[model samples]
Target chain A: MSTAVAHRPGLHSWLTLIRCEAKMVVRDTAGLVVPIGLPLLILVMNASAAGDEEITAGRTALDLYILPLVFTIVTATIGIINMPSFLAYYRRSGILRRLAVTPASPAMVLIAQVVVSLIQAILGIALAFAVAVLAFGAHLPVDLGPAVGIVALSIAAMYALGMVVAALAPTPNSAVAIGLVGFFGLGALGGLFGGRDSLPGPLATLGEWLPFGASVEALSNAWAGQPVEAVHLLSLAVSAVLGAGIAAMFFRWD
Target chain B: MSEPAILAEGLHKQYGDTVAVDDISLRVERGETLGILGMNGAGKTTTVELIAGLRAPDRGSVRVLGLDPRRDRGAVRQVLGVQLQHAYLHGALTVVELLELYRSFYPDPRSTEELLELVELTGQRKTRFEKLSGGQQQRLSIALALAGRPQAVILDELTTGLDPRARRRMWAAVESLREETVILVSHAMEEVERLCDRVALIDAGRILASGTPAELVAQSGAPNLDEAFVALTGKELEIEEESA
Candidate 1:
């Protein structure tokens, strides 16, 4: 074989990969239902439950709390639960190994998954916000800037943790099991079902230090028009860095 | 003489205590089809992977088109196309979509329509990979391997799961790529005899024999390549028992 100089293409190559990945994500309707459908369902249900009941010193209602919780569930479901299963399936099926021989590195696939998950998270948030505003007459955040910042940081932290699960799980089934454990375990600590103060003193203290708890606190504070605690933001940033570092150190291409 | 398209010397690979490839060396000229023939657990797959840069040898040097597979992996990828045994693509992607995605990796890729036609997948372009039959999936894989217009192509067990008719069709598609340096890893003696310019017979991670089909047949004093393979590897009794 003649050894011709290998051609190096630009960004177009990765764009194609991302497009294909997005198409596959769209086709997986069952997977999308949880991220998109569950949030809308929760929004309507929680809004009905509040029904003219004033929560928190007559200034806020249960609907305000539900909005943040719905946002958490949307980001966590896509970032922690959905992303790992897709990546693990790719690894178990030897798709990563196959891509190693081609000009495209397998890392592109991971980027594609992250991109699609972020898109889903954004869509889920948008749907919840629209429903809350139209049907429940919910007030918008006092400062959109900090609210967006908190949401972005929360997504980064959650996805970083998800990458760790994807790196360690040997199979798709194992990925799902581990991801669900992380989801519910973190969800409870973050007060997805109830107030974190309701938990025992030690558990509440531990939750305060965890990424999910930090994210919930930051988002809840932002939605309630209160200044977010600096420690919570720092914890989320720390979790994002540590979780991503661990995942990168142990990631396997095959 | 021109440099060999692929050269490997003193290859040794092991898994735990089991040796997968032991002191095997090979060279293939440009545009030559070299068949690696071996029985089960004979390390043919490992040898191909080493050559393709998918696996690094425990102790060996492999050069493809004058570049080290490990050190020059990016360059090697630009020139090498591989279809691993029992490998898969995204199940939800349609055949055309998968082809287009792979084609984007290469600077000068063959048109997707042409590739679909070459693999006889024109009629099934819109079908998802999971929905396609076994033969169709295999053909799509072969087409994807050729998407880069690779100078060297490695095909492992290309027709293992296909029906006889599909196998013949696959053979024809492979035959069309005769100008590329192709390393075919297979157990089917007839396929090697029909398509290979040279053959390497491996047994227990070692090369038992190497030559053309006629040379091997003549050396073993056998009626055909199949019996000659049995004679060379000394597996005639085991094969006979299995068949009986």
Candidate 2:
């Protein structure tokens, strides 16, 4: 019998793995719809009133507040809730353990899942932007570069938080439960229900430093053509680093 | 090519205070079929898992085709195919899709059609893993283990949920792999009698005896391996719980 050795998987193999990951995301109706749908719904309800009022520069309240909130929702929903649940499912079901025995490392699955989740986030952001622009006549951020930068930072921060959820959660259901609690807790403080101004002084101060609040505050500045606060950017960057560190320390393959 | 297909010596594994495998040694030469017979939780699974490099041995070494399984993981994985007890695959993936994914992980892998036919899963190629029956899932698991066309294979509880006809078909598949090394973990005496060139009886994480199925029966003064197994491993019933 031939004893030819198997080589590490190449780019084509990665594409195939990614394609399968995408299929799983698409097939889960609830996972597919909620992240985009819930945010779009919020945007539609708030866009009409917010779009009429200008906050600063050529941007309206819709651009400075509503749009940033909607975009953050897109990233947080996919990163915190959807992604972690899938990972926890794989771990609980032993898919990661099984892959560890094969030539393909389990890290391949994590990367593929991240790729798929990123695409989903992009799709959600695009849909919300389209509806806000065409239906409500909303305009793009005046400081487009900074706005883009903040959105990217927001995505990284939320996914880092999701990794923590995936690492600690023992089961798929528990992952979702934990993710939801995290989302709502952060959302409640970060102006998901209303502006942080309505919150108590110390809580409002804390909200501005958290990922969701910091993300919104930075993007709002970018929309108004103002310099993004150094503290907010620092907050997001720190959250990303700490979240990844915690996950790496606690995560198990099996 | 002349090296033993698998060699394990003084294997010891523990979980907290419980010993899963205790000072066990096993060797299988090239093209040999060794059946590891044990009652549930008798370290049969743990033994094969150690050999497969899925779990680390606290006080032993495992070599596959003369290469350390842990140290030479990449090379060892290329030549060793393992079918573990649990069917741990993505539930959303279809049979063909899962096969394709595994196929990508190897330089030379069996074709989807060939593997499906081998495991009698051709008709369910498009069916998702969660939708398959228990027996079908077991067959697919076996098919996956063979996907890489490995030189050595480890099969744990190969036909646990299979029907008689399916069991015979699986046995035939194993029979056809005569030139390859195989380590089969089983509780079925008939399976061991029919397929293994040699056998090892294990109890309490240690090997009680090992030889040809007929030799084991002869040594125990029992008519068949079933009665011989009881005679060799002690007839008293012991309820043992798995530590892992």
Clash pairs (backbone) in predicted model 1:
none
Tens-place lDDT per residue, model 1, B71-178, is 888888888889988788999999999999999999899999889988999999999999999889999999999998888899998877678899888999999996
Model 2 misplacement above 4 A: A1-6, A170-172, B236-244
Off by over 4 Å in 1: A1-3, A51-59, B236-244
The CA lDDT at B124 in model 2 is 98
Candidate 2 chain B, which ten residues in sequence have the lowest lDDT sum? B235-244
Best-fitting candidate, measured by lDDT? 2
Candidate 2 residue lDDT tens string, A175-233? 88999999989988899999999999999999999999999999889988898999999
Angstrom error of the Cα, residue B32, model 2: value is 1.8
Query: Scoring model 2 with DockQ, what do you get?
Result: 0.55
lDDT of 2: 0.88
> Candidate 2, residues B21-52: lDDT per residue as tens digits?
99999999888999998888889999998998
Going through the candidates in order, their DockQ values are 0.65, 0.55
